[model samples]
Target: MKKKFLGLLIFITTYASSQTYTTNFNVNTNNKDIKSIVDIWQSYLKTNSKEYWNTAETKDLKNFNILNIEGVINPSLMNWNFSNLILSVNLFSEDSYLIKSIFEGENKSVFAITNVLAKKENGNFKLSNYLFDYTKNWRSHSSENITYFYRPDYILNVEEVSQAEKFYSELCKTFNLKSEKLTYFIAKDCDNIYDILGYEYIFSKGMSKECGYYEIQNNYIFATEKAGANHYHEITHFINKFYPNANYLLLTGVSAYLSGEKAHFGKPLIYHIKRVNEYLEKNKEISLSKPFDFYKLDENTNPQYVIGGLLCDLIIERQGKNGLIEAFKNTKSDEEFLQFLQSKVLKKNENLNDVLRKKIKEISKTDEFPNRLKN
Candidate 1:
């Protein structure tokens, strides 16, 4: 009976020591002992089970779910396997630490940076909140005004960054606009983009694969390909901040005009212009008068973008740059923009609808029109 009791006591001691839990350390008294707390958090990350996570604080559980979905489950669904976990911790505040975790995977991997906030209650540190900065894991390169974040495997070249900055400056000068610091996020591929943006939100919106997208709210540009890097098209969207309430048609039109239509595809502007002309020729029933209604047209059949570009070009040519700027500043809707063009930009007696079609036909006949490919 004595030997049995001794053996049971040893087993319990060993098991209790092996189990990891969060450590509470008083900042004023035990500042140097914070490593112990970090160690416990790291151990919990590696060894904790789903049941343990389920019972954890709601904020921590929510963060864990985000990391699991984006970092683990989504990758697994895409045939990637993750391993080789690396965790780095830095003290953020008296009760919080910043944790960065990088995992190596067979197909692809993720690096996650999250702020782990804790509270001391009953002599134990309990997780309170987790605020995540998804881009923290990306490698960053910056100029004076622009910060570009990219994957480790794919990095932006110095020339590309320099050119992007130069173009931004030029756009500011051209538009008489002020410049602001910009952040660019370049994904490895389309799949990786879905990782940056939560899978459900992107897929649910029916967003098709494009080279890049400009997020106006966040002031960030998300790109899937190298061509998407520093494109004037996306930059134009940002510069349009000067005229927040401008007509959508005028807004996109000016961007299309200044940036050119083939900005993403690397073809000359003429390539897209010609494609639009061919589209117009094939479908004569379509009128450029209702350029705003071009959204109703099929994606392949839509000539609105090219039409807008040409119309903007015409406005700049006839009304001058100052006139175009005035229109952008004053026009609030598509109807207002159209009326502005009729009353101010174009000749007073000429019909507004005929001018655009006539210009399209004349430009289509020019040698500058691209004939090799449709798009």
Candidate 2:
């Protein structure tokens, strides 16, 4: 009985210690190299600990259904005394998916790591973490390729350059943006853009991805790829950068209004318009309600852009151009944006029910409302 109890105690201790990974592997490659890598990971885990998993930026990192990190190393060839050694790191995540790199270190060196995602007790793969180099060059990650110039005044290459330019020009005018300072780019990889700008407005490449906030930076937008005029949606996101933490409810409606983009699923025009009119009538009184879950519908719901745009237009009509701009420029969290709107825009006795009804009646009273739909 004494022997069995001692054995059980030893087993429990081992299990508890194994719950956290504290092992380190020093490669024979180079002392400086290995130490550098370790430093980066150590610093990152310290600042971005499991606690940050709940923050808006890396909430997904806390998914917790992942495997242990597998391998990490340097991939970039360019190096100086210490710069080149740090940039190479490749990490693999859940399902053995390769998540390339994360920059860490004193100089913010880039590392590419490979991870093998762990499975739950049920035997399905999930993400672990990354593995990469620390023993080499750290500055190799800071190249023009990794830099994004955010001058919203610049031009971008897309399908309709002229139309896009015109659209941006008008939007800048409406929002008091200095168009000469706007810089833009067209890139295929959102991850790359995220690294450069610390934020991105990605139009996804496939299904299974819907429009939502992506952590490429703490708050960036990624839209559905199939959008006909994706730039409009993305630029609206660009405009929204001015209002970080503004509620998606207000942001969505306001952006759609500013960019003249509409909500679209796979649906016909007239059918979509009718659905919009119905949704507008049903939720007209719920100012926050209409904009909050506008994108939460399923396949049966067609292009909601028309209605979404209209809703934003109604806001502009009520608030005026400067009001919209002030909403964007306002410094507040997601909750504060809503609170301000409640106190200022939707003050007591200013019944949105009557306001919306009158607004809708006035909007629908003219052919201009439908004419705006001719995108």
Task: Compare the candidates by lDDT and give the number of the best one.
Answer: 1
Per-candidate TM equals 0.60, 0.45
For residue 7, what is the lDDT in candidate 1? 20
RMSD of 1: 17.3
Steric overlap count per candidate: 0, 45
Write down the lDDT of every candidate, Cα atoms only: 0.54, 0.36
Q: Where does model 2 exceed 4 Å of error?
A: 1-39, 48-159, 180-230, 241-247, 261-295, 299-311, 326-350, 353-375
Error of 1 at 99 (Å): 18
**Candidate 2 lDDT over residue span 8-81, tens digit each:** 12321111111121222323325443333444433334343443121322353323212111100111111111
Top TM-score model: 1
lDDT of 1 by residue, 37-81 (tens): 455445556654332232344433333433333212223221222
